[model samples]
Target: MAYLYNTGYSSGENYAFLEAKGLCSYIPLHGTYKGGPDGFKYHKADDCYTCPQGKVIPFKKVFFEKKNHTKKKEYRALKPVCVDCPIRSACLGKSAQEKKFTVTFYREGYERNNARVNSPRGSYMKGKGQSTVEPVLGTLTQFLGLRKINTIGIDQANKVMHLSAIAYNLKKYLKFTAKTVKSDTKAVCYVILNIKTLITLQIRLLTSS
Candidate 1:
């Protein structure tokens, strides 16, 4: 179809799901401020992340969130890394402990979606959504059976939605076809009548002469 225009669509969720499915190019979203993970560099070979101050923060642990069942990797820098560093004030900003950053659940997907959201093509799609898709969805929800699905379970819900969509498309098709046929018929009748009138005028002129 056309570009997606979901105002309530979560970039994090979208990115994570798509990335997990290996559908899109993933790029992490970095914060431009001090104490942000974007300032750090990840070392795959070393199995750790390096801070802007050159401190090596090794992987501490991996934990799964019970609610979402997603795994999270935590990294922690040495306490001495922030101590006595010239830019420590700018990096830590008076935090008592050492620097630590977590690669949370859906990190890949969140990053990829974030990149798409900030890209030129993404922006164009966003604009198109505001102008087009949103209104269509609004119409469907308001006027069509899409307002609510009475079915339970994913399969039932999917079937209901498909039926609703079919109904809407059929309604639109009928209206469009009816209008087209009416206009075409009117045009043909007007042309035929004009031709017959012209022929009659020609015959009368010849008779009068």
Candidate 2:
């Protein structure tokens, strides 16, 4: 996914995640401040980015994006405020020309999306993970009738899990149509669908006739 990289924690985290994946990563620094000794350097440590005034750049602001309805965030440096800084001579002007403070921007949109997903809602969903969300587990224990494990060995246990998982999924496809697919909202249609589903399940289990 294309990202509007900034100078902040989210950018840092993303940089790490991408690095682990062995993907080439780059975060463009926005603003006019010339900073950080590692300017234009690929720093493994927050990419070694700094403000134009030699101060470490911090995550400055966050916003939203319209194209994907995601968050657009930016990271910037405050060293520009260094004109009156006590270390002004050592930070700005040609005398301190050896280096400058840096301003790192996280951009917007993509960063916000990242935060939203990592938020309470996102974390809860992540904590639940695939076992609860993707219907993979739902396909196993409930419909496949494979709640208990009776396999003999490691290989056998693995096989049971695979077969049961498949069977459970097959049952799910047969039981519900795509119209009643997953919805991330709570609405009247959702309520009615759930009620109908429960009633059908109850009748299938209890009726002797």
- Local distance difference test values of all predictions, in order: 0.62, 0.47
Model 2 worst lDDT window (10 residues) = 100-109
Candidate 1 TM-score, C-alpha based: 0.60
Clashes of each: 2, 27
Best by TM-score: 1
C-alpha TM-score for every candidate = 0.60, 0.24
Candidate 1 weakest lDDT stretch, 10 residues: 26-35
Clashing pairs in 1: 15-109, 16-109
Which lDDT tens digits does candidate 1 get at residues 81-173? 778878777777776567777676455455556667678877777777678766767778987737777878876676665556555655555
What is the C-alpha local distance difference test score of candidate 1? 0.62
